[model samples]
Target: MSANLQSAANPSLSLKKRILPVWNQLGMLIILVLLCVVLALFAPYFTETNNILNILKQSSITAILAAGMTMVILTGGIDLSVGATLALAGVISVMLSNAGVPAGIAMLTGAAVGYTAGAVNGYFTAVAKLPSFVVTLGSMTYLRGIAFVISGGLPVVLQDKLFIFFGSGSLFGIPTPIYIMAVVYIAMFFVLKYTLFGRHVYAIGGNEEAARLTGIKVERTLIHVYSISGLMAGIAGVVMAGRVISGQPNAGISFELDAIAAVILGGTSFVGGVGRIQGTIIGVLIMAVLGNGLTLLDVDYYWQLIVKGLVIVIAVLLDKLRN
Candidate 1:
């Protein structure tokens, strides 16, 4: 029948063939590979193995933060304070380590600090019904100030060699940070694709009222979501501290820009309720590749900042068009 044939030809007839988000990610994948190719051909030393390692190492911190950003953005909410949280956790962890705490416990303490900060954000955002932007924006400044006060405007040098290993060491010839990044992605991918909690996240983002009417416990879920974001920030701060072998209160300034940019580029909607970890990881790589490629071409850091800002604006424009 003609009707049947047309129906079969329509990709939307099957969930697997419907081509919005998935196909978009495919396009991103192609662009990422092409970027690597072009950079390799034109950029000096870019294709070298050691330089490749360096790129990954440099990208690790951004990737880690982007993972958390992905979750917050999925809910049509944002966390501006994550970068500040990084400083707070990093300084606290290092200060503890220097004062004779074990590396593992010190790291846990840092993560807990992040979690607590996230909880505060979530409590106000959900229970108090405040705008996430406002709450996190205020927290961002205060948290950074706290970091400065606690560290006395000095870097906290870490002597825990084991913690340092987490940042710079390798496992089976691969950077440890790479492994940490991979694990986060894998864990997030599994949660988003195969878990009820993940489905709830998507549902909440797509339509908060509808989800609430459907008995989703919107407030509780939001609290958990914000908490998760802080947890990821804390995790990132620990690795960053280890990488630098010191905790600098000034670390992570303007870092939120990169994380949010990566998420948006990866096909996540700012309007809430549509995105995937796969797209996010690809976006992360694209950002990293762009940064790396530009650096290889000897672009000035200020120019890079301009480029990054333009990328965010363009990505946002494209997102609006897509919607």
Candidate 2:
């Protein structure tokens, strides 16, 4: 009774020890709701059902990329090559389709290419002891080059009906990409929360040396992490190709930045091992809403870029604060 009374007497101590933590955890969700309310009030069409669905559909690609990125970043690493990988995979998939390959195989091949690229990244970073940033950056450059070379610096139109369905089709009035996003997030949530691999990722991010000492296959886990990242980018690439009905070597430029930003904004520590898949989904939604709202307000494209850059900076600052 005495201790309880003393604790109640110290409001500042209670706030610092209690309230702040809760705020840190929930700040993004609050921000998302507030942003939506403001946008709906200011942008007349923002609350329309069609516009809402469009936001989800358009944001699905980034959300997918961010999901993979969340895993990689949770291990205290980064992959700068995803954008390039998307372009390369998309290009290959389309070219294959044009060459009379079946639609399903072509899509799967694109995803495989992404996985292969990620595995290579994992090899250099995990086995060869190279920094992920340097390794992925090098891959980013070469992959983009390879994409351009293979596509002859031109876009390849995709005509496969089944392939296009994944990108632009809808079922039950919801866009297919949104459904894909849902599956990815649901699967990721389970993986991070309930799987041995997920626990290992967190452990490594917390302390790689300690995890290694404890018999975690640090190298193999990292390789898997990066490979998953690549795979997500590949899937996103296929969806993008389907949406546009073409494979452009230039698709997904700057996507890495957006993914990173979303992850960080969703309250994932940039240092790794202190985030959730649910938080990433909220972050993606915030980003999507911001962009959609700005467009509705008739903001110039250049200004939107500036706004997004500022948001990225703010997200980094928040991560630092959380750390």
Candidate 3:
């Protein structure tokens, strides 16, 4: 009897150990499902296919931006300027396309501008030894101003059909934005999981001094990470522009907050050195679902913002306790 009990306990204990890390990833999924269940119980329209697809479509831009923000945050850094960079990129891309520039060239130009802005943030943080918060905060203001200056505070309408296709078209009955998000996430997952650069990012986030001792080029990696964040912001800008068919100078306001919220809700530690891409995905889904459910229930938008803020605060508090 004693031997049998020990044997059973051994397997159960081992199983528990294996499942510990997975709990973080599973937590978000469980919450999302619970929320959906509640919403479905209360609101019949919550289960509609169109409503679901709209949630996914609306989440596409934020998902893309959050994917990149995950990499940066995993390294114990944040980019508050992503919202401004996104707006700036959208304005530039649409303006260029309207000026008879080729669609491809206009897109590239926007991405380039975003990259440069990210590089500047990285340089100040990594090379100049400034805090990322201060650097990105300054950038947040400056970049938004730059966008207004460039667009003269006017909205830029895109005339290129190809650009609109990226935003509005469907592939095999799925929205193009959904397809883009899927591709970007897959590629980002591969890079984060398999590449040397990805490993370096983890190492640095895990411990910057230790990573330096391990011969990881800490400064360069920081720069590259910020650049990736900027690039994603640019991609998000393009997607948003496509969706709206116009580039508004004030576009993407407070979007950075949403991206960071998604990252945190996905189980990424603000303290640095711990995060999962899969968790981030679930986090994005939760936000999307919450928004969808609210719309279905006809809840006020202001209440939605308040709820989101509370969720972030709770998540960060829980993260602190876990650490």
How badly does each model clash, as a count of residue pairs?
A: 0, 0, 0
The total number of steric clashes, by the backbone 3 Å criterion, in model 3 comes to 0
Rate residue 289 of model 3 by lDDT.
91
Cα deviation at 100, candidate 1, in Å, is 0.7
RMSD of 2: 1.9
Q: Which ten residues in a row have the lowest lDDT in candidate 1?
A: 14-23
Which residue pairs clash within candidate 1? none
**TM-score-superior candidate, 1 or 2:** 2
Total colliding residue pairs, candidate 1: 0
List lDDT for all candidates, in order: 0.88, 0.94, 0.89
TM-score of each: 0.93, 0.97, 0.93
Q: Write model 2 residue lDDT over 1-323, tens digit each, in one string.
A: 87667679997776677776897789999999999999989998999999999999999989989999999999999999999999999999999998999999999999999999999999999999999999999999999999999999999999889899989999999999999999999999999999999999999999999999999999999999999999999999998999899999999999999999999999889898889989999999999999999999999999999999999999999999888
Candidates sorted on lDDT, descending: 2, 3, 1
Q: What global local distance difference test value does model 3 have?
A: 0.89
Question: Candidate 1, 313: how far from true, in Å?
Answer: 0.9
Residue lDDT tens for model 3, 125-243: 99999999999999999999999998899898888988888888777878899998999899999999999999999999999999999999999999999998999898888888888
Which has the better lDDT: candidate 1, or candidate 2? Answer: 2
User: In model 3, which runs have C-alpha deviations exceeding 4 angstroms?
Assistant: 1-22
User: Root-mean-square deviation of each candidate, in angstroms?
Assistant: 3.2, 1.9, 3.5
